[model samples]
Target: MSGIYIHIPFCKQACHYCDFHFSTSMGKKEAMVAALRKELLLRKDEFKGEVVETIYLGGGTPSVLELHEIRSIIDAVYADYKVAEAPEITLEANPDDLSTEKIKALSKSPVNRLSIGIQSFFEEDLKLMNRAHNASEAENCIREATAYFDNISIDLIYGVPDMTNERWKHNIDKALSFGVPHISSYALTVEPRTALANFIERGIVKNVDDEAAQAHFHLLVDTLQAAGFEHYELSNFGKPGYFSKNNTAYWQQKKYLGIGPSAHSFDGVRRAWNISNNPKYIKAIGSGELPMETETLSVTDRYNEYVMTGLRTIWGVSMERIASDFGERYRNYALRQAEKHVGENLLYFKGDVLLTTKKGKFLADGIAADLFMVNLS
Candidate 1:
């Protein structure tokens, strides 16, 4: 099913490791809300009558917005699109913004799910990442939020420069204690130009250790799986009936309309992204102009995307789909490339659907790149 992703490009504070398109300033909040509503109306026909199954509020920090501002955006979506009877409306939030009063207000809204950004449960890790919330707030918010929402997912980061295994375990245990249905954990990658990157360059913060990250990944997989969380995607673990429908739809190549600055949209054949600058986006939408660029995917591009996403999620690439949709030539190319990895035990075929083995889960990205049809015409 198709979905909608709304990017809220404002955060209460800048996280040192974040490089996503967002502004720390809230001066343009009102103008932005109007612009977002206007942009939604502008692109109402893009989905081509497909019923929207999920509405994801991702962002600079959706939690930073007022409850009324969020409701206005949701109202705009309903006014413009054909949404499903019970769409999974999710709001990405930070612990610091999810106060008791705020959670109570959110429970009465259309947002059925809450994805909290709880990078770590230790104060030192929080300080290192410049997270907006302290360790106490992280724990307190989850405890309160769980009482109001059932479809909750929390994000945890592993492999911080000095994060020990014991501390990492504590984070996981703390999360499990909350009994949240889904957990999205990722490794700490120092993106260029981020404060974390600069710290490393200046020798102020130690570099992330690959070995330690790898170890942490295994720990995470084993711990979560044993606790009955399905390792559905490489970086996502969810119990039954709780896997992120929005993300799953995206991974399955379903079309979606992305709203707001730096947001992306795909209608199965063409992909587009809006201008990243908030001021430019607001001005353009106000002027009745869609500030975006589009690209139509070639057959090779589609095939590569399928391979990359397939390798990361539970739904592995189907050999039948490869031969039928991408042609025998592309199918043959995939088989030829997969042979080496299959022999290396990093990849295996389950009757024609190629899947990554547990040992190679952490290396899925690199292996998928190797299997890509780089120069195919």
Candidate 2:
């Protein structure tokens, strides 16, 4: 079974540290929704007679759209694609958009999961992140939504300049109190062109320290594991059976078709993505053309991608599979690299499954890069 992702490229406001493709303007909301529906129908044949096991409505803020708009997109997917009998449909929403009435409405919709953007449950942190919702809204929305949706996932950010360990612990504790089945947390990162980066460059805001972030990560892992949530992926923690099916499919390298501006898609080995422009995208789709770029994966590209994603999850890269798919030369290069790290205890082998140690999890991305064979074809 394959997956489908729909990107809603509009937001209510800009966050300080976000670099994802989005526009704060709502001028094109109606047109964009139409374009998205058209795009889904246009790409119906891409998945090649496969059933859609998961449908993810991600975005600039999918919550900004009206419930009818959201359902229209789901209806288009159902009308044009072969969806599973009971697909895991998810919608990424912000706290402010999830009013009591809206949550009740969503309960009747096809969305079975909610990935809410609750960056923090504190006023100061919310203000610092330039979040649209305040602390009250953050807490209230979760409390109300939990009554309606059993499968809920909320996002939390750590390593912000003033977020002390005590505060971070409190944040995690508050999230746990909600009985949320899944939590996806990440260290606060300042992208090159984001507002946070400019503030740091001008000494208006403090920079994120790697050591502090690492410490927070350790605390997060311990806290969640103690609560019976699995550290399934580097940045994800979930109770048993509550892991995100869509993201898991992605990390496992399953094929998915991304619909809408700035979305991405994968077809086993090839990769493609739409342009990060609203007007341009709308015009192209209207003209029966895809405003995007595609790349057929080279052998090295595929191998490196495997190493990158495998190391981040509970599933480790398989030595035998690598040898079969990428040949002995690439496998030998990986083993040689693995040999050095294994000695340092960064990565360990369970039979033939090469997995990362707890200490290696934070450095998994770097370690994966070290194992990449740049010269190999």
Candidate 3:
């Protein structure tokens, strides 16, 4: 099965810590929507006849679009591709955008899932992040969304400066009380060139403490485990039968077509990404040219990617699958590299699956990199 990811590259405001491609300007919304629909029609054949099982409206706050505009894009997708019956359609919305009326409208549309960006439950944290919504809006939007969408996921961030352990736990409990089926919580990372980074560089804001971040990670694990939520991924937790199928497909390397500025697509061996500029993307697409770059994956690149993404999930790397797909030499190297972690009880080999222990989950990336074999031959 395949998926379609549509990036709505418009936001009402820019958050301080964001690096994702988005524009606060909404002047070109209509034209951009047209271009997106045209893009869907133009790239219809890229999926190679695989039924589209998921369609995700992500980025720049999809909720910013009007109901009609959102539906138009969904309709265009159906017109171009063989979308499966009852495909999982998701739209990523910011907390302030999801009013009761808006949630009701979305429920009537093709969107079956809502991924709300609540970030944090504290007004001070929201202010520090320069988020558009306040603490009340975050809680209210979840209530409104849960009233409409059953397959709802809310995004939260921990490890922000002054976010104590107790407050972080309260955030988790608040989400649980709201009846959200899925939760994707992340530790705050200060990406380079972002306002947060600048603030730290200038001493206006304290840098994020690695120790605080690690403590918050452990708090997430214990809190979610107690709530009966599956730690299916490094940053995701969900009740049984509520895991995100679109995101799961991504982790499992399922093919998807990303339609919008800064969007990336992958078939099995090759990956392509669209140009990040909105005006340039719309202009080129309007002129019937696909503005994107393509790259074919080398053996080492593919192995490293698999190790990186797979190790982040509950599904660990498979030594046997690696042997079959990547040849025996690479497989042997992986096993040998995995030995040190296994000895430390941070990794365990159960049958063909080499899984990371709970203690090692927080450092899965480091361990995965350690297991990586350089293709020097």
Each model's lDDT comes to: 0.94, 0.94, 0.90
Worst lDDT 10-window in candidate 2: 40-49
The TM-scores, one per candidate, come to 0.99, 0.99, 0.98
Q: What is the lDDT of candidate 2?
A: 0.94
**Clashing residue pairs for model 2:** none
Clashes of each: 0, 0, 0
Which segments of model 3 are wrong by more than 4 Å?
none
Per-residue lDDT tens digits for candidate 2, residues 82-127, read 9999999999999999999999999999999999999899999999
Cα RMSD for predicted model 2 = 0.7
lDDT of 3 by residue, 53-169 (tens): 999999988999999999999999999999899899999999888889989999998999999999898889999999999999998888888878899999999989988999998
Model 1 per-residue lDDT tens digits across residues 166-254: 88998899999999999999999999999999999999999999999999999999999999999999999999999999999988999
lDDT of 1 at 322: 89
Specify the poorest-scoring 10-residue window by lDDT in model 1. 41-50
